[model samples]
Target chain A: MTHQQIRGVYSAATTPLNADNTPDLGLFTGHCQRLLKEGCHGVALLGTTGEANSFSSAERRQILEAALKSGLSGDQLMPGTGVAAIPETIELTRHALSVGVSRVVMLPPFYYKGVSDDGLFAAYAQIIETIADDRLRVVLYHIPQVSGVPLTLPLIGRLIKAFPHTVVGIKDSAGDFANMQALVTAFPGFSVLAGADPLLLPLIKAGGAGCITATSNLVADSLRIVYDHANDQARAADVEAAQVRINAYRSLSNSYVQIPTIKAMVGLKTGIASWARPRPPLMALSAAEHADLATKFAQLP
Target chain B: MTHQQIRGVYSAATTPLNADNTPDLGLFTGHCQRLLKEGCHGVALLGTTGEANSFSSAERRQILEAALKSGLSGDQLMPGTGVAAIPETIELTRHALSVGVSRVVMLPPFYYKGVSDDGLFAAYAQIIETIADDRLRVVLYHIPQVSGVPLTLPLIGRLIKAFPHTVVGIKDSAGDFANMQALVTAFPGFSVLAGADPLLLPLIKAGGAGCITATSNLVADSLRIVYDHANDQARAADVEAAQVRINAYRSLSNSYVQIPTIKAMVGLKTGIASWARPRPPLMALSAAEHADLATKFAQLP
Candidate 1:
């Protein structure tokens, strides 16, 4: 109850793309607004699920701005600003701050894996010091399976110790509940957000703040219910039902490559064909795959 | 050999840094010139050894331009321009072509691991097609251990078939000689460069085009000797002796973390401390480590 900075369910929102493979800003903005309307605490845009790393620096900046300019408040938006290059990370973070957004989810300088904790610390310290923005809040990203750069407990402790105010939370996406539980036990008053949908109820019960998950893009209502009532004895049944619905969505999404499938599901849920199109290096679902998914998706709770 | 396209010893040049960790453009250009003078065929700046991903897009462009401005010809420079983001990769590559540097080492879009071959193929095809420059000649980068994205043989075949002229060669930095040999066997007229120092002689013997190696940063003279005389029976002894020297340098570089140690050894070789200052996310060798390396470095053949 005491250890939460970023609370409740945030949608690890998927960005829609036009035929030309550029971010469909209007569609993207609408999705962000819908996530908020659907009970997401915030739109955590440009995360891994959002394919932030797949987009160029310019495109990332544009996507963030589109979200804010389309009437989402700075407080309701938490865009991912990290990239392989520290300078660009700085540039992106500064752009967010310049546009009145303060919170960002940042992956480490991920291109160089097997890097020493000293180097990783230096990278983050330099970024925070260089930015020198007191309003900034960074949720340290721990998606080692994807980024290939793990934020170990010691590293997270050091980052928290050094930049206590700025480094407020983390999104653990490794899908290991034991590891997530360990993170919660290790850090006090720091948010530990589940990066997976299935863990939302259990994590919230384990004193985690909430989640920023791809399933929230589809089942934000259920995720919100789970987050809000995880500790309530009377509401346990409702929360369980919500959790089941989320698991159903997550299961179907994982049937294909998670991110593209999630996007395809979002398109199905919204009836927006553009939602199905992903940028290169993350192929959009093939026609038959999408049709198959659509049929299965129709039977989801 | 008839299969070779880009044939020679190319140094995966270690970029020198200022005290602030910015690319010391003058020193970097100087190192490029010195690498060429030391008998390297060309300076392959901004590969992994160059910490290219650690640098911003603007910084990457500057590093490439600095080499050209300092009198290196287009044919004498092959910069690595691929990055996690497809558009940035395109931007960097297009910048290289715009500046008359046609040959560039390109890594596949690497953020999404376990990606489908179709997605990977679409990724490369999009970049190549979007660039659409006839002058462009891509040396596919296959460093799975580092980049987390391997340019598989099948993927390489697909790319080469699609853009036979543009996708001309590959730098197989996976350090897997079997993979390198397989690439050479499967693709005729495709240059297969060894990513490690020790493999140069054997790869050349097995029909690899040449090498783009970190050890070449310190032992370019030896690598060039091996590349030139690997197959000549009359020079076998000389090549063996040179490779032995290259191995000695590489061993000491690996005595600590390879990249920082290579930079430190480059400093030791050139009597320039600036070479030791890597950007954040790559720590410089400690003074004690440098002193120890210097002691052993002086004894190398």
Candidate 2:
């Protein structure tokens, strides 16, 4: 992987919220430490699974500060600093860079629908220029299904051409393997992290960076096993079979909401009831649903 | 209209950004004042047209404060208090209420896609409970095309049933006339503000409160004419004809991005170049496009 700064398995970790919906800083910091110990290369904090957009800019900055104060190293963190606002995005990105976190995954401004590629490019350009930090490394986030904004190949190429050093990698969360493969083929030597867990092995084998996925939150050690041995022919079948099982687990719970289901799984695994509660607009799994998921999760190979 | 707190044509005003992309408070206040003078009943600051989500929480609060200081009455202002975060939304809503702005338009938590109605209800419920303000009057914003979240009638009914006084109105920007009509029919006496200019006449005829439209930013006086006479059988044809012209203008410039084109029109009309520049992720219209729009705008009936 050419973009080694952001290679290997990363978890788009879940954000634990208090009863009043405030970020649980202590729990979040602990989760980061746990993710690192569970075999994740780094934790992609505030990514979709973390409910990044659901927190205010102040809260996000405070969470970052708390995480750092609690002994989480910048090298092991890549916070999702993207926002609908350019200045706010710059503020978060600058804060991340100023604190020694070099790489940040950013979503394009997503509030406006049917925005042009030029608009999207101008947004990234402004953030880059405004931050004006040479050390700033951006891993573009592409999850059009949710954001309603796609970072097409042409746009990605243009961004890279304009700022080759600053624009380092991309997390293709489109969940289309073909799109991920095309991104890998188009930007050879560029870090192409898969957003979906099932594609982790294929993406690693395709000369790409590892995955930054939500599933890695709970199964980082498992994902790292596949990532580490993706090139080993002897482990190829086993990795594929394990991926299928992981995919099955993902599919079963994903039939419900992803963030809440993942939270429920975390609660079930850790026996932390509060972990099952997602912020509003994302309901916690029902007792029955959690029981069913527990049975299915236990049944997974 | 039954909901007098938010009746009549309102401009979903454009947020004026300074050269550095900061909210130009003076410019915004001037625009609001001008809208009022031009026959707008009120100004809906920070709606989709106003690029509400594209600014940080602090910036949004500052803009609202400036608008108030500039002598815009809270009675005639409905600032959008919606954000992806529940606490932030509650904070903004509480600020609006505390400052005497009883009516505020709110968007559902839009970051999570395919969220259940229960989840959406939870979000509003939490906000209402947390805010705990009897004076707070919320006008739900349903711009599914942009927000990627719809406030279906059932959900709206649920919110109203839960908090009838707080959840007072809806701005249906789904761009679906049928949806707006359904909302109006389903919730008799509930305020239904048309989010599109073209639907203003029909919506008003169908018992909608009025339109809170982007076009009202520029053509408030004209829209007021249609809204004021929507039920007059003798003037029905005239109102429909005016709506057709408004729709034409919207359609023409919307062919080349709505917000930027409107901003360009404002610049052309006022000779303020900065008015045309949208915050990043929203590129300004090229000189050529501006010229074309100017010609089209002039030719409008």
Scored by TM against the true chain B, the candidates give 0.98, 0.95
Note the DockQ of each predicted structure. Answer: 0.89, 0.82
Clashing pairs in 2: none
- lDDT top scorer: 1
lDDT, candidate 2, B1-301, per-residue tens: 3544568988999987788888888888998999999999898998888988888878888988898999989988999988888878988888888788988999998887889999999999988998888888899999888899988778999998999877888998888999888987888778899898988888877888998998887777779889888888898787777777777767765858889888887776687878988887888888888878888877777
TM-score of each: 0.98, 0.96
In candidate 1, stretches whose alpha carbon ends up further than 4 angstroms from where it belongs are A1-3, B1-3
lDDT of 1 by residue, A1-301 (tens): 5657788889999988888889899988888888888899999999999999999889999999888889999999899999999999999999999999999999999888899999999999999999999999999999999999998999999999999999999999999999889988989889999999999888988889889999999999999889888899999899889989999999999998889899999989989878888887888888999999999999998
lDDT on C-alpha atoms for all candidate structures: 0.91, 0.86
> Which lDDT tens digits does candidate 1 get at residues B1-301?
4645688999999988887888899988888898899999998999999999999999999999889999999999999999988889999999999999999999998888988788889999999999999999999998888888877788889999999989999998888889989988999899998998899889988988898999988888888889888889999899889988998998999999899999998988889887888888999888899889999999999
Residue A214 C-alpha lDDT in model 2: 88
Interface RMS deviation of candidate 2: 1.0
Error of 1 at B179 (Å): 1.0
lDDT of candidate model 2 versus the reference: 0.86
